[model samples]
Target chain A: MPSQAFAPPAFADVLAAAARIAPHAHATPVLRMRSLDALAGCALHFKAEHLQRGGAFKFRGACNAVWSLDPEQAAPGVVTHSSGNHGAALALAAATRGIACHVVVPENAVAAKLAAITAYGATLHRCEANLAAREAACAAVGQRTGATLVHPYADARVIAGQGTAALELLNAGIGLDALVVPVGGGGLGAGTAIAIAGVSPSTRLFLAEPAGAADTAASLARGARVTDIVPETVCDGLRATLGAPNFDILRAAGAEAITVDDAGTLAAMRLLWQRGKQLVEPSSATALAAVLQQRERFAGLRVGIVISGGNVDPHALYEAGALHGARA
Target chain B: MPSQAFAPPAFADVLAAAARIAPHAHATPVLRMRSLDALAGCALHFKAEHLQRGGAFKFRGACNAVWSLDPEQAAPGVVTHSSGNHGAALALAAATRGIACHVVVPENAVAAKLAAITAYGATLHRCEANLAAREAACAAVGQRTGATLVHPYADARVIAGQGTAALELLNAGIGLDALVVPVGGGGLGAGTAIAIAGVSPSTRLFLAEPAGAADTAASLARGARVTDIVPETVCDGLRATLGAPNFDILRAAGAEAITVDDAGTLAAMRLLWQRGKQLVEPSSATALAAVLQQRERFAGLRVGIVISGGNVDPHALYEAGALHGARA
Candidate 1:
């Protein structure tokens, strides 16, 4: 793939992606928790992508990318470099189309996540736990298998596909005052920006970023992509550096960053599980944490928060006592 | 309340209850998990009552009872004796109607459950951890406050309310071959039996009971209600002895019992959280466990499993490492 081919997805592309992936991806519900509303001082409409296929919004993008390929292109199958949800999402999407899929996983990837990818019938290619090694491994597998590479966040089709979740939310007629999405590789955030821009122009876009992995915030502030941060956060899903195309789209959309510490994210995660009765991962909690932390900004407003994923390791959560406490 | 007044609810009452509680209760989604279906060798239609108001199917019954009261009857509010979901559900239901709610809780009740009852603005009265003590305490509260006693699973109105969940599931046009529900005091089980009988008479009713609290199974076997078991299980919600009306209704409906041990319930709970991405409690898992345990009976059938609740103590689940295992 050439750099020139990496143009940002337009709102029309998101519309097209929505149509393309409708047959595959789930239109997850928009849930309202009155208790959560009282705690946050806002009417929170949670777009439950955690309940989507593959248990994440990543499935939308992965499905779109796989289905968008020409018949000949798809015959050789699709490949991607992901240590998390995208790997499983791509595998599941490919399985639905009866196509082969390959995933280049880092050595340090979570075992449970890797198991999920394998369960979805994707061939795994192990690589060193770094960007270069992951990319090199993915490239080698793609070259050998004649598989099309689906960049998790940077690809235009993926961005458009990710926007479908927001498009569904916007179509729900909730009239959200603002939309908050957790920023990882920025696929969801950038795509949400495009959706809000097209469907609900007045609705503001807010990116929830972990303070430990605040590269997205830094990139937006500097008006350029930042790729130098060594991520350290409980939110495993939001550990990636923002992709260049994703950065450009988010910055262009004037999306604001709301950074939350690990403590806040964990607290919010507990609230979602305990009060909201939605066992979402820490990354999903960042969006709610941002709303709770900045009460003045969201108070009394109809705020839309995207629950990005629900792929936490149950054993790890139990062993670490991650949600343990009297308050929990 | 007189023992003579505890008439078994008919299909007509369930129909009335559905209309009465429609505004207050959630018509929870019927979720389908392909992986779970594959694992159980059956097509499973999961009635997600865990996503119901107050995070359990108890809300349907509680709300119906609260709203079924006339102005004169509702003047002093409502009271109940419960160690878990019923307490919180009644409290939440009373709150919706702007009425005072009182819960007589056993001393041995989970702290998290007590906290939830309190959070819903219900006054909690602690008593000895015995059925006699609980009944006495509840009676005292009702007398002192002039409140109507809303027996958790015995009252006709409550039973009718519980039937609404099964009604919704049956109305989903899935044509279930069998319907499974957890049987504690058997409010949900009896209600579901009524619903199945009314709408889908062809659908067999199966009660999923905890082996540690298998009073329902014993009662059905011996053709009489049993009340002499000291329950010991992680499923805190399924410890109550079966009510006479609940037993009679279930027996008349020809409902069968499927007993699952604590280990099987825990494993199923893990699967619901991991693969289904629904963080349900041990009690809810019993239904799925029963289906898995008796695969020969359910194989190639459309099985409907009601996920009873999602109000597990997050802290207890973490600190006890309840969901800990390599497979989790």
Candidate 2:
């Protein structure tokens, strides 16, 4: 809560972030599915951020944060503690800026994701597989190398950059009545909320969380941050604790939260793959799953769902798909 | 070939096809990949026809052919003998026209594809698994119900309509040095050749074929059609013998034919899935595989590759991906 001492990202910052990242980021396509619309009883506009650089939307925020640094601050490098899309995105963003990047990854991080981060030319600093150890390692790297530490979601610049995705969607002239985004560390959710407020005030914002990791939903219901719970879902990208600043913006905007079980999320993931012709991770599928679970609330409304990322491990996807298929 | 006696589809017909199918068919996006470019040493522009309605470029031709029928002819509806993307495309196109569609699918056809065709409201008639039986069943359906038979690829209207994809690509102002398309039944390849000749005549045309189904390469080499060999590749959609009219057009265009082995096609399919974040079938992967396998020829050139379709069975994809991963 002490993070409240720092200002949250404003709507103007979102505009600036959009302009800042415009030359580097992809203007991802918006796809429509008639079958999905018929099934959900609503028109669905999918923002394909899975097609973003580094195979995720994380690049937008990383690019913004890296570019926002002053010459002196950027001279040494940038550092982050992530073993997932954020790490890879930050590495790529640093590469674009022609600066050094050091990622403090946990010892047991997914090898595929780690390979992607290293492939983007980031130096890897391994730490124990826990939050405290990872943070200590990241701090040590920053202290030793004079690298600026960019918190994955809690940072204002990162949130503002992530908001540009929704900014582009709302500006595309589609009259979406609602926008659904997956809530993890709440960067994308908070960013989307701010963008919707600035561009299309009438567009309702909804945050989708995995039922197994419903910290965001619990936090919203309790009117307080929930950080002590352990996440246990197939959506590996969405297991982070909610960021205080992100929660502040989301709560202030009166964004609603919905929880979907892993089964429902997997089904939605399969639909997106089978009918939608897009490869997105399970975390990205949660937004659509939440919408489908609450069909009556969204019936006849035009909705935009952000596909967060597509850096899925093929083996994991295969196993999950097989289990889901057998159960079906 | 006697089919050469019939007038081939002209450049004007491609224009007409573009206009005719504009209201119904999606003008799929053109996707570029920097990583793919770096790996292949070529600037690759992918025509994402895999994202087309019914999940393939077959929809364009099917829509045009179905719409080309006059009121009297359309009254009885259109029929096709296919158990692949073409059947599904034709069924959906007929649905748009509010006409009955009869698909003569083989007995051992892929169940998923058959389900797609029937789900689009087509009447399915099953026959023995062979070309003769499929054609006989199609003929019987035509005689029984007075239905118009629409060939999958050989028809002039179909080829013209298929050419619209290349037309749109060339018209997009990107000066492509060459165009590469998979030569399954030669529908897309011939259409692309005709479009290139009409719009960007200097852009060379290349036809990619799976080594297991390298009939096109043999045909081009021997200056005669090679129709006796059986296709044994993972590219199920390309198993059909090349149609006479399609072969004639491709041959006359002086299009170069290249062959890639199944291993290369599978690897390329995985690359498209893992790196490109697009779900493309093996047949579609052949184009990129050919480019990669023949990198010496396409180095530093800007090439347009058609991702022909994306309607893949998840089980098959999983198995292929697992095998490829194990091999890697």
Could you give the TM-score of chain B for each candidate, in order?
0.97, 0.96
Best by TM-score: 2
Docking level for model 2: acceptable
Scoring each candidate complex against the real one, what DockQ results? 0.50, 0.47
Runs in model 1 deviating more than 4 A are A1-4, A326-328, B1-4, B326-328
How far is B240's C-alpha from truth in model 2 (Å)? 1.5
Clashes of 2: 0
Q: Across residues B1-328, which tens digit of lDDT does each residue of candidate 1 receive? A: 3222777789999999999988888888888887799999999999999889899999999999999898987889899998688989999999999999999988887786788899889999999987789899988888888889999999899999999999999999999999999999999999999999999999999999999999999998999988888899889889888988899999999999999999899889888887787778889999999999999999999999999999876556655767566244
Off by over 4 Å in 2: A1-5, A320-323, A326-328, B1-5, B320-323, B326-328
Residues A1-328, candidate 2: write the lDDT tens digits.
0112457888999999999899899999898887899999999999999999998899999999999888888889899999888999999999999999999999998787788899999999999999999989988998899999888899898999999999999998999999999999999988898899899999999999999899999999999999998999999989998999988898899999999999999889888887787878899999999999999999999999999999876566665552357211
Worst 10 residues of 2 chain A by lDDT: A319-328
Number of backbone collisions per candidate = 0, 0
